[model samples]
Target: MGRAHVSTHQSVGGRYRLVEITRRETNSVRWYADDLRTGRPCLVTRIGLPEEPDGAAHRAPARVLRTTESVARLCPGRIATVVDALDEDGSLWTVTAWIDGTPLGEVLAEQGTLNYVRAARIALELLDVLDAAHAEGITHGELSPGQVFVREGGPVVVTGYGLAGSTTAPRLTAPSYAAPEQARDERAGPAADLWALGALLYTMLEGRPPFRDRGRPEATLKGVDRLPLRTPVRAGPLARVVQGLLRKDPRERLTRQVVREVLTRVLSEDSGAVAEAVPSPRLRGGPALALRCADRRWSGRTTVLGTTLAVVTVTVAVLAATQSLPGTGSAADAPAASASAPGDRGASRPPAAPAPSPSGTADLPPGYRTYRAPEGFSLALPAGWQRLDTSRGADLAYRVTFGAEGDPRTLAVTYSTGVGSDAVAVWRDDVEPRLERSGDYERIGSIRSTTYQGREAADMEWYAEAGGSRVRTFGRGFLLGGGRGFSLRWTTPDAAWEDGASREALRTFLRTFRPAAG
Candidate 1:
């Protein structure tokens, strides 16, 4: 058995001087203090202990120092470095290097809804640290916005590494983020951290946690464990990703690998400028969220701030931590002209506008509209069709698939900045090789070399089985000079391939397609 040391830090100047508080969670107060020994500003957190303290008080500080320092070594600069910890005057105090940033909770308190791209980027950073910690069997178990530092010009730094078993309290730091198992007082593992991640992500995008705080810690935990999540209207592409991670059963949550893949693709889809830092939260942003964590929580009057400024200003648009503009378009400003929200997948169609042909005349097809995408491309799509899924590849290549729900016909637009000059050889060599590997792929005819809108292009048609349905695909690849190219693949049930609607839609797409520059 290990002996635990319990002592009081007689401060106010003996070793450190309390400057000001930065955050307040359940039974905890985070202070910005000055270290008397080194004359350096640092952060000091105060957590209240039970009326009668015991051996646990001694273990809490030791665990915090040991766990934090150990994980900090593994992740290097990504985690907050704890300096000292002690128990004094019936409370626990943990000191750490001064972070020149604001807590994530504070940021949300001021900024209202953050940019979708920025949220994704932050989530990616958090996942990176959690991935490292989880690999070593270390569960943060106590992750919350309050434990995250959003510093300027640096990676997101995580705190509260060893707080899980440190206390027998639920929501000691953040109740809204507690996993179901944690709420139920059941043993939690890595999946619990993932669930908390989803809650944080949801909070950043929706301006509140998925489960509303109910004044008391136990009540909030009960709501979290029992209440169904309201559909988040503002998460955009990340809505599904958030829901997947928030599943009630820990066994069904998305694996770290899958979350990483989706988030990476989302990040890669943005332009090179997406590496910038997002604005931090205001220090005195209204009535801040009171200590929502701890064994016993107090109720505070919470007001939701609403700002009409949906899109970021021109300065922030060029920078990303991400802006989440449509199609991850970096160079183009988001046009207010979009009738539908960017990530909206609803089947209903907006009033149809005329299909603009390559000649710029709106006289081509009756049931089609020229959909101008923020990615700098335009094509005529059938009225009800909308962007269904987007995936990006290595070398800055991305594919956007579109179709209406309950419609078997789908069209995919792929763009790549790296391609050879010969379009025919591309389809026959690069493209055909992949198709051939698919078990059910069968070519319709020889690859045809063609000129599309005065550019060298190649067209290929093939049949493949998907979901037990035989489908015909018409693929057209065209070069836009300097190795950049776009490919359009339209697939329809084999039975409908020869119908007038299918033929007309294909013709409209090939005739009216425009590059980003166009």
Candidate 2:
């Protein structure tokens, strides 16, 4: 959902230097990256979360890490182990041990319809992982061909395990595979995963989804919700089982036990249908390890649908989901959905005193100084404030946040290279949709068209809950011409908004900010 534009050859978090664009989807991208600290290769994914108004962002990374670790322990070799989950700029960057396999989607592209026996074997393995998760009351929420990786020798590894329910987006990456319930924006449950399992199986055997992706996630989801599934011609013995899983009603979808039985029966009965297991191709004479499809050619068939929301909206949602910024609501109660979008970054720099302003810092508030960023922006900050986090998107949009430990307030500055010309329209068309989807978002007033430092701008204020406390945020965004724009977001606890210091801080930031020279 963040800008669909990350450049290759940049380092993420100053550690994972992206070397190649492995794969791209509607809202996410895969990278072949090198871990600078350990000299190891890793697979990193960037996913745009729903924009919330409160503490959702602060809690997201921990949730992702905890869920991933728990599931990895439950299903050892079958799950991709997460190395780190970070909230950067406005995206979640999840790093995992490099996987040595081709994405199932890529495999499908290379070898269209898979043999039923092979598909069954893969399904059983997937079910094994799902069974372990379901037994612990965890639902995958998002299961699609893109999330599954197949080794040349047939071992399947699943990624994006802890991503369900991470954001408010109904189905982040693959809308065609979303269950009828998810497509309708209802709470997703284990049944949703079953539907996706059926969809994946259908795709494996039919060379396409039961409901094709019709360019827009909402449209595709509508099809999943309302359209009768096409009859499977190549599913063979798997047809009935696949159909059972894809039932429109969640209560009617086949249960895991029944699915397991059907898949096991197929494997047992059609012994000759599976290709004989072969040795995995070796990488440097060791186990053949490849980042998920890093070596494969980019496929035009698999981009994020064009009807997806704008990048600014995605970044706003991610910032809300990851930063726990005031006015962004919590995602604690949202059900897991799917993982299917974009890039991530989380690098922190030590606190440093702001550089002396050419215009003189003598007039600044007590204990405040000017901090000049290497990113070409500058602003006044409280004495102890420093760069706390930074994030980047595929479209080259980035956000930098500044704060001090023990301080609940945060100032985020976001720059986007792909923005519309009108500031009010940007907020209404690009931003408001995302905020409305966030929990407990209440706008204080109409979006006000204004001017800042001689540039046309718009301001919006809203309130939401963050960690059991009501919080508020005021944001101002302006155009810099040539499709470029920057936003200043300041968040504070609702109770503290009236504090003299907080009021002064907001004024200082707004009065002193200078965008990097173009």
Candidate 3:
């Protein structure tokens, strides 16, 4: 006979609120019940050798019930309402509270990029929850975009705890998002959550998994090992922050405090201003127009309604005066006799006075060519050119010169918050080492004493190969006291530098440098 089906419920002797049935290989069923009087749930499982009679299930179910009771006492949470060994029927069923919201992956696919500020805020909030979960000694075994729900408020992680910590059930798989240790079945810890966070950020920004693809596992592993990440052209500081988070080694990844600081900085109201300071593909359009109008003040232009009428009046008067004159060898030769005439005095009068100057008559400064840098140095630019103020961050000054063919030569000046000695030290300790390691630079002569805008300056020149092409780098450093300094660096390709006109223009610019107001 088929094993009898036994039912289990939350309350024993009361209507079976829930039911679980165990069918033995011997075709017998056993049922376990929860007594409503205690308002507690119990678990029952079938235990015995396959050859044993199905009736032996009673002992196994009792053991499971006792274990559940003990676990309940220790766990100190809601008691399991009901549990039952399934009939060797080879199927299992479980249910839990239903959750709402779309999957995070689906949401990201629909929205090209999340609101960065909002995303950062949410991440910070989630970190708080994660910290608590870690303290509870529970590692989210399956943390992935798919497992996270993007709700109206924020993300909610949904997973089965029993299945998560189970040894019998196959461990949850998230190869792409999982930490290296977690993938190897090693002890998963809080670090695994961080790894997943990195994967999540990468996926959001680049619209792809940070380290996974449809291929042989080994190939994917190799790709991950050699993953190359470049900041997207327009992605500002967020790109740098993401790169930090995605470091291959967990120890190298940003700490929670660092992450919070970065997020706070990127999400701040002034972040847009900071981002505007950086050159990026995203701001190439419209910014020029906005910049041009930034400081302009306009009042409505005056409209003269009598311009047409006035022109006609003047023409008529001139024709009449000319027509009345005698047609001699010259009108001037015949006009000497009209001094006594009544119209003579009026005719001799001068034309109406011209309009007055708005600022009154004054001699303006001669347009001499000059370059005005911040205190401590100066140079000269070619005549008839103007300095452009690029209102970026602390790297205060920038200017551009247009070539005959409409190409542009750009000059940038960066201020460093270090003294003269510190500035030289930085160059010697940091920049010089990097240049030497590049193996493409040749040191040129240095000028120990130079006069720039009437101030003392030091000049250095070097030639380097960049992108398989030779570039000339000329740098001048100025020391402003109180631990601050400024440097001007000019670079041009060898071909451009070889042009006579370009060379002369650069020389003129160097000679005309002057100090500008900070």
For each candidate, give its TM-score against the true structure: 0.50, 0.52, 0.34
Steric clash count of candidate 2: 36
User: Which run of 10 residues does model 2 get worst, by summed lDDT?
Assistant: 315-324
Tell me the deviation in Å of residue 243 in model 2: 0.5
On the 0 to 100 scale, the lDDT of residue 447 in model 1 is 65
lDDT of 1 by residue, 1-518 (tens): 00000111325426877643355554455656789899898888876655435567557889999999888877887788889888765567889897866788767654656666667667878887887788778899888878997765666789988778777775466677899999998888999999999999988888777997554578889998999988877776567678778888887777776666556555555322222211112111122122111111112111121112233311111111111011111111111111111111221122323334554436667777778887778877888989998765444556678899999998777665424344554455334543665468887766665555566666666778888999877666666654356667778888887687876776666556777673
Most TM-score-accurate candidate? 2
lDDT of 1: 0.63
Name the best candidate (by lDDT): 2
Poorest 10 consecutive residues by lDDT, candidate 1: 319-328
Question: Residue-wise lDDT of candidate 3 within 344-397, one digit each (tens)?
Answer: 111121122222122222221243334443434454444454544332222222
- Per-prediction CA RMSD (Å): 25.3, 16.6, 36.2
Using TM-score as the yardstick, the better of models 1 and 2 is: 2
Candidate 1: give the clashing pairs: 26-293, 171-294, 172-294
Q: TM-score of model 2 relative to the true fold?
A: 0.52
